[model samples]
Target: MIYKVLASILLLLVIIGGWSWTEYQSARNTLAVPGEQVSIDIKKGDSFDNITHKLIAQNVNIKPFWFKVVAMQEKATTKIKIGEYVLKGGMTAPELLAVLVSGKQKQYSITFPEGWAFKEILQEIAKNSYIEHTLTDSTIDFSALMAKLKVEKNHPEGLFFPDTYFFEKNTTDIAILKRAYDKMQVVLNEEWGKKEANLPLKSPYEALILASIVEKETGAKVERPLIAGVFTRRLEIGMLLQTDPTVIYGMGDNYQGNITLKDLRTPTTYNTYTIKGLPPTPIALPGRDAIVATLHPAAGDSLYFVARGDGSGTHVFSASLKDHNAAVNTHQRKAN
Candidate 1:
């Protein structure tokens, strides 16, 4: 009788051990390989229970009770991150926990095109649902905004670098603007120190002004240096810039796409045709190439240019008005 009791106890212990091992393996195995991924947002101040609930709602259908038990055991609740996370199908219970605790939030991207005005940049930011919009084009006071950004500039045009910026959701538009602004300052200062000698520009800001004009003027990449050369030569000779883009910018809301001879005669702070030297500020955001071109213009005798009128978006260079007029007539006739 004693032997039989001992044998029974040993057998029971073996069965329990085998069951526990099986349960442990099952817990570790992939519960369900998600056929489709689902996004989950772990908001700030969310409790561990709330996170578990959110995971379930995101189609992470696993053994919720067991997953929770495992999470608590691993002390993952305290380390959960707050951000957007993607829950995939093939992840096991431990894998899901690892992902949640890893704090790998989803990131989104926004791009500001080269030559985009500060107003247009604001418009883009306001329309982006992911970015937190605390400012608007209509309400952004240049002085106040600059003060807040610690920038002592009178205006903010051409200050922000145009590029694709990535950030997690809920990031403010101001933050993005600040980053772009800082990037432009760094790039401008670095390139300004390497500028070519005898440039008409007196300061980095003046280079930015001309660079903005060059950015708008550059139809072909190769023409950038040539355009810069022409502008620089014109400035050296005290001739009106006569650039159409600056006139358009000056026209602002009144511009109807086409500029007439009358518009050229109209005067504004940004009207290069009517104003002498560089504009009071950059007319638009300039790219790195445009800035570099303005600072280091190619040496040439050409002082005037006209559209090639071959749909190639290229310009014809001329040193004299007679040559420029002849080329203009040829191209204008072709264009007409």
Candidate 2:
């Protein structure tokens, strides 16, 4: 009877060893087709069981028992991060556990293009469903927002650097705004230190205001310095900027698709035709090139420009109003 009991015990040990080896191999095998990918969200306070269920629901061919065993072996059960994670098809159970423990969450992007206004930036932020919206309204309280960002300027316009910003899911809008704002400050200060001497700008803020105008004036990268030169010369000579964009900005909600003679004659803080110097604040978010162009305006005698109106988006530069009017007559008449 003792000999028979010993043989049965040996048989049970062999079976258990075989099962353990099988599970170990399974833990190392791919969980899905080689090139397949899946996304899963692990919320805060989620249990290890909950994560296993989530994986299974996403069609990942993972054996929960083996997965848990591997997690225990790696000591990753208490270390998995909470965020959106992308799992690859060829990833083994151990590899997935490593990724979760690393906290390398999926990144999403939001872009603020050059020449966009503050209102447009706010609207874009509001439209992003992945971001955590913390602001009270689309028309943000500028002073309060600036305080939150720790920015000295009360106006938010032209403060944010226009570029593609990346963040993990559920990042706050204010967090993104602060990043952009800080980036702009760094870039502006750097450029200001390198700016050419004798420019009309008194401070980096003035450069920003002029840069915003240059950005709104043209989309052509090559024309930016030329446009800056015109504005700078005007500022030096006490000539009216007469920029239509400022007039339109002043018109605000009242501005239609086009500006009128009445609009130019009417006075507002932003209307360059009526105002003597730069606007009370920046009118739009200028790109790096615009800021650079404003600081280092091209050397030229030309003081005025009109669109070529040939759909090339180029302009005609002139030194005298007579010549500018002639070009305007030629181009504007042709366009009409």
Candidate 3:
């Protein structure tokens, strides 16, 4: 009787092992495609069962039962990352499992251009599928996220380096912003280490502030240093920066092409015409070129510059207040 019982148990074990092996083989065949591409979107907070159902409903040619079994065996059912995946049409179960486990999903490139403010940046992020556009207002409440990240700042302006970032679709806007900020930290630290000694900047943060000003002063690719020099000189002499862009930024959405005397005299922290120093924070995102220009301004005592109004995106730098006024009159007042 004991022998009989032992034989029965051995037979059951063999049958169970064979069934498991067959199930795995079936899964591999179900997903095996050669060259076709299957685009799949995995949303955030999706469970294994839901993801299986989604795939089945999409006619992905993946067997739900076997896929679930394989996922469970590989401990990947709960681990499929949320993102857009470009699965090759004829890939096997193992291949799909490997891709999901390794988190090799489709990536979309999102670019943040230079001179964009936080609101613009957020808008750009919202326009991309990679981010959740929750804040529809002009001013985003960055305090909550900043506090969560333990960052001491209320806004991350110059802190986010402008670059083309690759992200999986359905990513949160905050996550993308954090990535930009992290990249900025790396770039800022590297550049700060190479800065010239005795710069008027008290810290890396100050350099970024000056860079932001330089970014707004000129759009000319090669004239960033001269613009930086203008601001740095004014800062050294305790002259009000007197930048019109700050005024424009202060006016926000209400700013038309016209700048009134009242606008310049507005009692705002960003009104460089009234403020003797840098604003409380950066006005826009400064590119690496602007950042470099801030650390190495052109050698000059000229304290003024004016737009040429030629629509060539260039400015004329002047040394004396009289020269600046003459250019302004000739280019701006007389022409307009």
Candidate with top lDDT is 2
**Per-model lDDT:** 0.87, 0.91, 0.81
Candidate 2: how many backbone clashes? Answer: 0
| Clash pairs for candidate 2 | none
Off by over 4 Å in 2: 32-35
- Candidate that would win on TM-score: 2
Please give each candidate's TM-score.
Answer: 0.92, 0.96, 0.77
lDDT value, candidate 3, whole model: 0.81
Clashes of each: 2, 0, 6
Give me the runs in candidate 1 sitting further than 4 Å from their true place.
1-17, 31-33
What is the C-alpha lDDT profile of model 3 across 1-336, one tens digit per residue?
999999999999999999978877888765554357766678888887777776666566667777877778788877788777877777777677767677788988898889988778777877776567655566556787687556788877677889999887666776777789988888887889998767789988999888888888777879999988888888888998999878888788979898999998887878999888998888899988899999988888889988888887788889899999999988878658
State residue 246's C-alpha deviation in candidate 1, in Å: 0.6
lDDT of 1 by residue, 1-336 (tens): 999999999999999989866766676785643676678888889988887777777667566666666777778868888888877778887887788889887789999999898888988888899998888767789898998788999799889998999988999988999999999999899999999998999999999999999999865778899999999999999998889889999999999878999999999999988899888999888999999999999898999999888888889999999999999999967798
Q: What is every candidate's alpha-carbon RMSD to the true fold? A: 2.2, 1.5, 5.6
Q: Assess candidate 3 and give its TM-score to the true structure.
A: 0.77
| Model 3 error, position 50 (Å) | 7.7
In terms of lDDT, the poorest run of 10 residues in model 1 is 24-33
User: In model 2, which range of ten residues has the least summed lDDT?
Assistant: 27-36
